[model samples]
Each structure stands twice: as C-alpha cells, then as structure tokens.
Target: MKKNLFVFLLFSCFLTHSQTIRKYSNEFMNIGVDAAAMGMSNAAVANTNDVNACYWNPAGLIGLEDSQAALMHASYFANIAQYDYVAFAKPIDDESAWGMSLIRFGVDDILNTTQLIDANGTIDYNRISKFSTADYGMTFSYARKLKLPGFQYGVNTKVIRRIIGNFASSWGFGFDVGFQFEKNDWHFGLMLRDITTTYNVWNINEDEFNSIKGAVAGQNQDLPQSTEITLPKAQLGLSKKFEFHNETSLLASGNLNMQFSKTNDIFATDVVSIDPALGFEYGYTDLVFLRAGVGNFQTVTQIDNSKKIGFQPNIGLGFKYRGIQVDYALTDLGNQSAALYSNIFSLKVDLSIFR
Candidate 1:
C-alpha cells in the first residue's frame, strides 16, 4: 500500500512539472500514424495489438498475450509519404515480455532546383538530385506487469536516423518510459518520451554549403560547420477512460507537448502548449467497432483574434477478422488558410502469430 502511494505521488509530480513547460518540436517525427488514425486521442494508451505501439507507448505491449506484428503506411501533404512500424512481441511467463520494432519514413520524388539567370530575371529549373528523403528508427522494448498493486510499467530504447538527399543526414538516440494503472472500469496512463535529449547531427555538403556561404560570403564566414537540432521537447501525457458498458466507452485524454525550441531560434526559450482530446468507441461483440475523436493544440496558442490555430476534427472505424484487425481514420485540418492543411488516411494490419 505504501509503495502504491509513492507511485501515485511520483505520477502527480510528473504532471505538475510537465505542466510548467510547454513547446512542440520536430513535430513531424513525433506524430504517431496509428494515433492519428484514432484522431490522435491515445492518452489511455490501449494499443496492445498493433506493432506501432512500440512508438505510441511501449508499456502497452504488456497487454499482448501472443506474438503479434503489424504495419502502417501514410501519405502526408506535398506528396511526402511514410511507411512505419513492424513489431513482434512474445510473452515470457505471465509477467514479462520483450519486443522489437522498426519504423521508417520515406519521402520520394522530390524535385531539386537550381537558380538560372537567362534574361527572364531568375528562373529555377530541375538540377541533378536524388529521389527521396527519409528517416528511420529501430526500437527495443520491454514491458512488465508490476507486482505493485494497480501499476504497470514499460520502457523502450530507440536509435533514430534522418537522411535528406545526399547532402545531409543525421543520427540520434532516445527512449520512452511509461506507466499505467487500471481498476474496475477506470483506466489511467502516463508516458515520457525522448528522454535522451536526442539531437540530429547534420552532415552538410558543398552545394548546400555554398548556398549559405554565398549569401553571407562578403562577411567573414566559417568555411564549413556542423550543427545539431534537438528533435522535440520531452513530453508527458495523461489519459483516462471510463467504460459504461461492455461494448461502450468514453475516453477523455490530454497531453502537454512542450517545445523547448522554436524554428526561428536555434536556442529559443521553452514554451508550453496544451492539447486536449475526446473520443468515443462502440464495440459489437468485439468484432466491429466505430470511433470518433476531436482534438486541438493551436486553440490555446494563437495570439491573433482573427487567426485560429487549431480547429480540427477526427473520425475513424475498425474491423476485426479472425485474429487480424484493420483500422482507418480521418483528421480535419481546418481550412486552406491554415497553409498545408492535411488529410491523413492510414491503414493498419494487426496479425497475431500465436494465441
């Protein structure tokens, strides 16, 4: 009982400290495809079936009773696409489990351009360049149902890499740690990700070098330099769920994704932003499921009274066949005024190898 109290207090502290800082960074890599399919409302972290759970909340692997694997693909705005997630988890005894996962994001067919001056002011045309830019990561995870009453814990270690044409590539490492508790029909969860202070170390080449250097060539400039960018601020999230019946549940989850740096400033001060989400799911014999969710992050951050930051909605559906599961989701991105508004369509395949 005393240990349980300590754990609760620790979680409370995490929430308090988490609230004090707010910022979002490298948000592109942080967006989880599976979560997006569910309207990004995954605070309770109940994704034990899909391999993408390795990216969502590794602790969720505790719910897997058999070896399972899955794959997910998505197309973002500007013809950029991503392929993510394959994982296998096997139970060891009844209390412990281990898993491995691979996540890859590929953006192909990007047009490369060079400036040409031929009477018509400055014209830009296709120059010699490669087909895509990509980022990939590998993760190893371990999860256990703790003996401590009402508590479960899990952790993951990841190696991350980014490749931007042949001119730039970066590598980094990070980890995620999480805890969850359940009693009766109520569930609560907490997770902290990117705790290693991961940063992308860029290796820039000559063409890229000359572009920056030429712009400021008149001034004394460093011939060549290496720079690093921190991925995203470490984040802590809290979620809760209440099941009204065997087949129906209502979920309310929220996250404070802090951004320690901003795009304009390489070393900007930290800022805190709040993202709250609500979702509902209905199940029929655990075979067919319908879900809808809505969330917004920019609502609280926008300074202009006329400028709306976040005002989007999300909806999805799922089906189960034998032991295989498939899911789809749609997320709204306000309007064209938002610049690069996105409509994400994702497919996930979950297969259980052993039951």
Candidate 2:
C-alpha cells in the first residue's frame, strides 16, 4: 500500500502542474484533414482546389469545377484513437464559394478505473465502467475572388468542442483567414489559424471532481482554472505545376509554418520558430498520382547524449475517375518521427454525379 500511495502522490503532482490552460490547447484540430494533404506532409495549402480546401485553404475552393463532398477516416496509435472528417463545398456564380467541414478525433472504450475501489475497500470487477474522450471541430467557410486577377481570399468561423466523459467539457470559437495569389505562373498561399486566439471555457463536474480530489495531498486542493487559450499560428506556401509530354505533369509545393515561441524546430529564434516542408506530386493523364514529402525537422537527443537532426518522410497515392477521387497516405512511416505511423485515406465525390 505504501508503494501505491507513493505512485499516486507523483501522479498528483504531475496533474497539478497541468491543471490550467496552456499551449497546444485544441491541438486535435492540428492533426489535419484530407489524405492528399497529409500525404504531401500538409504542403497543399497553395494548390488545394476541392471540398477539402474548406479545411486547408478556403480560397482554393474557387477552383472547384463543381460542388464537391469529401470524407476521411484514420486510426492512430494502433487503433486506440480514431480521426474522422467530412466536408462540402459549392461554387457561386463562378465568382465565390461557400463550404462547411466537420472533424472528430476521439478515444473510445476506455475503462474508468477511478471507481474500481469502493468506500468499503471492496474491489469488484462489476464496478468498472467504460467512457470516451473526444474533440470535435465544425467550420463554416466563404471565399471570394478579388478584382485583381488570380487573387482570392477566404474566411472561416469555427467552433471547437471537447469532452472528457462527465469529468470536464469545453466550448470555443475562433476565426481564421486565408489568401491565395497567382502571378506569373506561381501560386502563393497564406493561412492564419486561430487568428483571434481561440479560447475554450471549461466546466468541471464537481461530482466527478469528488472522485479524485482526495488523490492529491490535501483536501484543500482547488479546481483547475476554467479557461484555456490556443495561440495563433500561420502557414505560408508556394507551388507550381509543370506539364511534360501529352499526359504527364508534376506539381511541386513547399510550406513554411510559423509559431510564436522558440522550440526544437530547425529554425528557431527568440521571437518565432519556423518549420519548413516540401511536397511533390507526379500525375499521369490527371487520373493517377504519386506523392512524396518531408517535414517536421527537430533536434533530438540520443540515448548516448548526442544531438542529431530528425525528420519525417511521407508518401501517398491517388486515383480519380468520373468525378470521384480516392487518396491514400502513410504518415510517419516506420516510426521515423515522433508520431505513430498511420494509414490515412480520403474520398471525394462530385455532387453533380447525382444529377
């Protein structure tokens, strides 16, 4: 019993440190959506031109030839977590576009061991229960072309919802803006996520609080702060396509992501950190595509106390026919990066197909 008590004390101490809102809040939204983008290590911001653009860069929606819908599903951490996405977009008068998207990331069927030991010190298997923790994001997007040729801009109003069974829940709202420009055969894009500094107001269930309040050292332990903040971030990208032969083409893109703090990123400074990514797609007759990318550079300390650079490489395949598209990407292949390897798949359909 002494050993268990010691472990509990350590765990409580860790919890106390993380009780308040801090960096990386609402991070599930950053996991990203759309297999095509992830396949290219999320470097498609400048060239995304479908329903999926609603999540990547809504400005790209102006390039959609028809109304579109997309669906994606991915399992991570050996199936312990599930990520799902859906989106729809429609162009208006060939001058603007509107869209909506939903994303859900969750871990289900988790055993609630907190109640396993009763007040009488009686342990019963039947006392164990199951619950799930999930995060959801819904976004409404609109885009319009400017008077300047090849210039388009977009905006997003998004809502974030997070739940931890009956323990805690939060709701947040945020705004994002994106822009796309084409000049002299070059495509440039900018995406500002959480531009307004997203905030989540949390509500803790005191009834659930009673269960673990005693785990800490004192009964005077206070409830955690109820407000969480997500800092703003941005991505800048450039892309271009080259055509060769009768039915062969290649698309190359690169992105630089910026954050406000110093970190392990390859290019980190006191005021900001920048992570760069590169992606390429080779298309055959516009029907099949092969994609590749590399990104997420960081300095890692080896077991031997040596520092070295580490990066993630991603590859993907795509096929499209009759206004339908299927894309597949294996991010973090072979655990080369900190993230677990997962197979991502997404499907896109032209709503006109039903006509």
Query: How does residue 333 of candidate 2 score in lDDT?
Result: 69
Q: Can you give the lDDT of residue 48 in candidate 1?
A: 34
Runs in model 1 with CA error above 4 Å? 1-25, 35-37, 44-50, 115-127, 211-225, 229-271, 300-309, 333-355
lDDT of 2 by residue, 1-355 (tens): 4324633543343243234656577878888888888888999889888898899898998998889999999998889999999999999868999999999998888666666667787887687777777899999999999999999999999999887777777889999999999998799999999999888888877787667565444653577677877889999999999999889998999999888888888898989999899999999998999999988888778999998888889999999999999999999866777777889999999989999
Candidate 2 local lDDT, residue 270: 88
The window of 10 residues in a row where model 1 has the poorest summed lDDT is 13-22
Number of the predicted model whose TM-score against the real structure is largest: 2
lDDT score, residue 349, model 2? Answer: 96
For all candidates in order, the CA lDDT equals 0.55, 0.85
lDDT of candidate 1 over 1-355, digit per residue (tens): 3323422433332232222122332334565656333555443354333345566667667777667766666566755675565667666667877778777877676543322222364544443244456778778888888988767788888777766665456566777786767676455666677666555455655675454333332531433234343344444455455555566654555544445444222223446334555566656666776676655444322456453345446666777777777776665534412323344444444345343
Candidate 1 versus the native: TM-score?
0.73
Regions of candidate 2 where Cα sits further than 4 Å from its true position: 1-21, 215-220
Clashes of each: 6, 0
Query: Candidate 2 — worst ten consecutive residues by lDDT sum?
Result: 9-18
Q: Using lDDT as the measure, which candidate wins?
A: 2
